[model samples]
Target: MQMMEYYFGLISVVAQSSENVLFLVKPILPIMLRIIAPVLGVVVIAAFAGNVMQVGLRFSTKPIQPDFSKINPNPVRFITKMLFSRQSVMNLGKSVFKIATISVVAFFLVKKDLFWIMKTMDMGVLQAFQLCLLLAFKLIMVVSGLLLILAIPDYFFQRREHTESLKMTRQELKEERKLLEGDPLLRARMRERQKSYAKRRMIQEVPKADVVITNPVHFAVALKYEPLRMGAPECVAKGQDLIAQRIKKIAEENDVSVVENKPLARELYKRVDIGDEVPEDLFTAVAEIIAFVYKLKQKEAVNV
Candidate 1:
């Protein structure tokens, strides 16, 4: 049997060793995924929130794969960027400020407990040291306050870094968008159809407006009044740019009054909604417009 084992020694395997276990660990990619999963999840959620809060997301691929080949390695750039610029200066200032504050607090606390310290000294050296510990506690409290202040900038910088790191290259952005949106031509055509439909609806509604108020040529707000439903006139529509000019043209074609009360027009557009009552603040302003429209209607009735 011994001779057989020597010849077939390969048939027996030694138990797994730490080195073997570590080798197994190194090859397993999922182990690294499991470790970083929580961090990735946090980053995704934070990036989403940051996108919403910041400039409403103009997606770019520039941040994702930035070129650092031309990175400045000059002494000024290195010193300023590495740890001595705006953020670092703020940090250093904060640290010195906190130390000073804590020191002042500790000094006051030590003086306040001086009587206790004296009494404790008469009792024993240990009790006197305990009295001095009161100052330490006050210092801790002041230091904690300073830390809260310091954490504000740290949180902002973390979000800023996250934003910078997420930047992508132009090609990366196009590829990612292609993957997500599919057939760019078809997507653009769909958008044009939607815009055309909205335009048709706007054209149809412009004729029914009681008054079309214009900022001469920039802004247009259309109002409609229903005595049974609305306590006062409500804005049916408000548009700017090409839509505003279109509204004015349609108002002229439909014989609807194109009022020039810029302030009243602005107020109606700002404070009122479609099919809602005009605000109390605008009551006087809108009442005057209504009176003018009514008189114009009375005169037209006589002419007919």
Candidate 2:
């Protein structure tokens, strides 16, 4: 059983390898390195191409490498799986095809019975070995071709298995959607809570603001300037949507007057970040608003 297994394993490897090597056959000849370089180069290229087809060019630690013994062993379970499992069906079918091809081919060579093969002349051992080597290489190519045919179906099955394994289920889709967008009711509650939180933070910082900009009904921003941190106006608080309404309400409560300008409000929201300066392009419009707000504070102070 062990001898049978060892021989089977050897044949299986030869059959598989032959497929890849057959691709190197050139009616075409390159003048230089001939068989050696071209064969190695093609093997590397084909392996690379095959790998890319499987994973679309990414790197990871996953592979379908099976335990060495399970591939072909004297053991009954290994043999059973190889012959009875679906994988067995595929493998056996491939093997039978490859074996028939190799048998037919080897028979031709055997009948040619070129006594030259057995003729180990008094010629140097090196000369004799050179003859054997050529014959062996020829044999290898024939086997490789057979293996490649088998590998075609094997590659198809492997790809199908890989894709099926990685395909997402409906439940996975739903879970991913939930993660991206929280439940609508939950989202609504979060927005309200965030609005209230913003209002409190805005009011606490309102009196210290250099200016407050608004769309009157919908948007609001508060900017602060400090000489030491002194280069530009910084948004101390900014808000939109329902939160924009809340910010306007908070500004009113804190005696921070609001100015309504649709363009200015939209521009600030798009270009400025909280605690960051309004861009230079908006300087004229923003400065004009800041001056107006400052005048309002002075007028209120005078009235008081």
Candidate 3:
């Protein structure tokens, strides 16, 4: 065979002159590199592309992070899982099927070219190498095509299995919703209780007011003032509609003066809030009302 003759010639050259050995090897080195480089490049590219196809271009370092759970405490359970787990079983089945199919295909392919393969024994080294390279290229192409067909179904099956595994029961869904959003009924009840407490506090403030100003029917603003203790007249309580009616009733029961000033009541209700000082712009109007209330109280005291 040409291969045998080539090796024998190299041996003779090595024996004749060790310096000539480099000359013979120099040409072969480039040929070997040329033959191997494309296959290696293809393998590296295919591995990168396969990962990109599966999970896109996203990158994560989580897989390399130290995990206590990975340290199995039970050897028997770990061994059983490795041997009989669904993923492991599927992997083993796929490997066996691939090997059987490729072997059968390779066997048939070689048998078809048996005569041509045998004739390579009489051919030159380069011719025989070319023939083998062509056969290998065909074999790889067939194997890659077959695997591609198998991968389509495998992809869908894995996706369906993942979806099934992630499904939650009604109780689990409810718990997850509660964890994320809180209980709506409990929130509503708390809001109702808060409103009731605020109303009670506002009613209490009405009795402490020196005078309650009313818009006759719709609005009420209760103000308190003490020249020695406070800076200016402050709205102690304020409300509209039913709350305004309640404020008037509380003022009457407590003997606090109730002054009907439609414009003052509406302005105070709009511009000021409970516990806030009355604005300076309405000082003249408020002072007039306060003096009038004080005169009426003085007359009542004198009568008593």
Candidate 4:
């Protein structure tokens, strides 16, 4: 009412002189800012708080990223789902119930005060306005209380729906764990594949060996030496158990000399790797074996 009176006064002033328009508008701007400032401040704070509650203090552009999933390819099915789904039906029913209940409450409230409302016409305009305001306040309080009562069941229903939506399938759970901790099965398969390739490469190198030293049953270490290229004998292949058997078979198939030297084979298999030179501590023993093999090859050459 005061605002309406002020606007009416401003109109009267504008009618008298166009020059006075700026004077009236200047004061109104400050008053408008005073009214809007606190409301704007509250809105900004609430929005900030809501974001913090939902995702902590993190900042990301992902929320604004275009989501193609929201675009329905089957419009007919989308419309049917929107209108006929259980959730839609429940929401429609709740809206109808709320409107009907509020209408009934409002009707009865007015009916109870029907006499007092009728007497407002006989009272002064100011008194009638005050009575109307009081009645409107009462209606608002009652309606708010009714809505609060209705919200209790709604809160639990929404909570249960949210919980259901969050549930994951076994595959989804596995994928999520894989993303967080890495896929253990995939990692193991890769390791096994790497070992297989390594073993294949080692077996290939065995055919190039000058001599194979073996524990006779459990261990094998194949050595190679190129006098002009290599400074010392290098283990071309080394293995134990089944792999040892495989190395010995490969060496024998390639006609590489196999010397039964249990202690030398065990030490080489334990301490050396393919492509590594024999250690300084085992140099004397390895040199003796190499000399014997070379002498045997020379005798075979002379006989041929």
My TM-score estimates for the predictions, one after another, are 0.38, 0.43, 0.52, 0.47
The local distance difference test score of each candidate is 0.73, 0.73, 0.87, 0.87
Worst 10 residues of 2 by lDDT: 23-32
Clashing pairs in 1: 61-168, 61-169, 62-168, 62-169, 63-167, 63-168, 64-167, 64-168
Q: Which stretches of candidate 3 lie over 4 Å from their true place?
A: 1-130, 138-181
Ten contiguous residues minimizing lDDT sum, candidate 3? 1-10
Residue 81, model 2, lDDT: 64
> By TM-score, how accurate is candidate 1?
0.38
RMSD of each: 21.9, 16.9, 10.6, 10.4
Give the winner by TM-score: 3
Per-candidate total of colliding backbone pairs: 8, 3, 0, 0
lDDT of 3 by residue, 1-304 (tens): 4654586467765755556677677767877788789989998998889768765797889999999989999999999999999988988998898789888988998898888899899987667778887888888898889888878877777778768778998999999988897898887898999989998998999888889999979999999999898888999899999999999999999999999989989999999987899899997789889889999999999999
Better of 2 and 3 by TM-score: 3
Residue pairs in candidate 2 whose N, alpha carbon or C atoms collide under 3 angstroms: 18-144, 19-144, 19-148
Compute the lDDT of residue 53 as modeled in candidate 4. 54
Would you list the clashing residue pairs of candidate 4? none
lDDT tens per residue, model 2, 157-256: 8889778768888988878877899777898999999978866776677656766688766677887767597576788888777867777776677766
